[model samples]
Target: MPHLTSPAPTTAERIRSACARAGGALLAVEGDDPVAVPVHHLLSDGSFAVAVPLDRVSTASHGMAGSQALLELTDYAPLPVREPVRSLVWVRGVLHSIPPSELTETLDAIATENPNPALLQVETPRSTPTNDDETRYTLLRLDIASVVVTDSTGAEPVPAADLLAARPDPFCDVEATLLWHLTTAHNDIVARLVSRLPASLRRGQVHPLGLDRYGLRFRVEGNDGDHDVRLPFHKPVDDMIALRQAIRVLMGCPFLNGLRARR
Candidate 1:
């Protein structure tokens, strides 16, 4: 197979993009025994902001502020296949409660970018913790110390500032549906993409793996094992219209050439 230089998203951008797709993570905090709680969250200002159920973790553990905490987010492939896991993001950080003064403002800024319904369920800092608190949750933050993103390529540490600066992939949200439609309704189109691969890789059964602004991915189920490969578009495309044109160009679709002629 030809050794292709991967033109993938920067580690920072990939981390942030994965976080955007993640709905929940395993929140591990220090205790008599390390406590790992499954919780939904919001990422804001370099922290994993979560609504911790009152019944789950003790509120007095606040003394452990700045203590070690771990947050794990898993990214799955857009389409179902033999190996569905796409990437793993592990964040090492310190866990603590968000003070009342900052709760409203922090959520406000987060809402502007991510108006996740989970944020609406969070109680205001002034609200009293009630006996029925099991149904409710408290706001807390995991201040990041270091982050590591592991994917098909390999594992590497991503800087905190770099992750904060990067934006999620423009096509991340629609990628799954796009791949699903192609695989279920247009398998031949996706299979046509495999011809771009080297002769050696074409031996296996080809399946649509993923889609992003940069290009397409194919998972080949070979007799030995599954092989993942990428075929980059002529360039990055940020929207559906541009993406349609890019794919057509990559596949040498004459339809796109007709459109370009008019321009």
Candidate 2:
């Protein structure tokens, strides 16, 4: 029997991508008593930083300034499935609060690399604020010691340097929107794609599961069990134009309905 596999993004790439689109994440601050800190986080290069509002900081402030913590960031399948977690990343590190004096400079550097809406709360108000309480934020950074990523393929360790250097997938930001659009607006095209599966699995309810730079993954809900199928592209695509062409190829015809096959 032959084995099957689909090409996937590297572990570092997956980790970086997950951080970029973090939705449900948990920050566990470890000590004699482990504390779960609510955080709004940002990732710059390899730096994993989070902003904690002072009002809520007291909960985990006992040993939080310099504590061992693990940040778990998970990526779910764009479309809902029995198990929606598509990928998971664990970052183990020591937490360090950014000194007040350097907060402005640090935020500027982070914003340049990756501008996120989460930074709004901690941002220095444009005009001097009357009440300092309104803008009190304790900026914290996780000095990453090690990182591990897990997905359908398996688990793998990522080096700090590799995570820093790795570039996120070009399609990372728009993947969810694209998949949702495909299912809602152009389901006829989705049905066409599902036809590539084996006859046994064709009868199952089809759900758009995952989309990456390399291929598309679909989940088939059936009587016996659920099945996941991958429609691999001949080559990796990094942009929308190439993705459209790749998808067309996967739809079983490289050309349009009216067009004749190339000789």
Best by TM-score: 1
Question: How do the predictions measure up, each by TM-score?
Answer: 0.86, 0.81
**Residue 100 in model 1: shift from native, Å?**
0.4
Those runs of model 1 whose alpha carbons end farther than 4 Å from true positions after fitting are: 1-6, 32-44, 59-64, 126-134, 257-263
Reference-based lDDT, each prediction: 0.75, 0.73
What is the C-alpha lDDT profile of model 2 across 176-239, one tens digit per residue? 9999899899999898887776676566788888788978888878887677777777678988
With a 3 Å backbone cut-off (N, CA, C), the pairs that clash in candidate 2 are none
For 20-67, candidate 1 gives per-residue lDDT tens digits of: 777666766766344333343446467777666555555645444566
Which portions of model 2 miss their true places by more than 4 Å?
Answer: 1-6, 31-45, 59-61, 123-136, 199-203, 222-227, 256-263
Local error of candidate 1 at residue 49 (angstroms): 1.7
Best by lDDT: 1
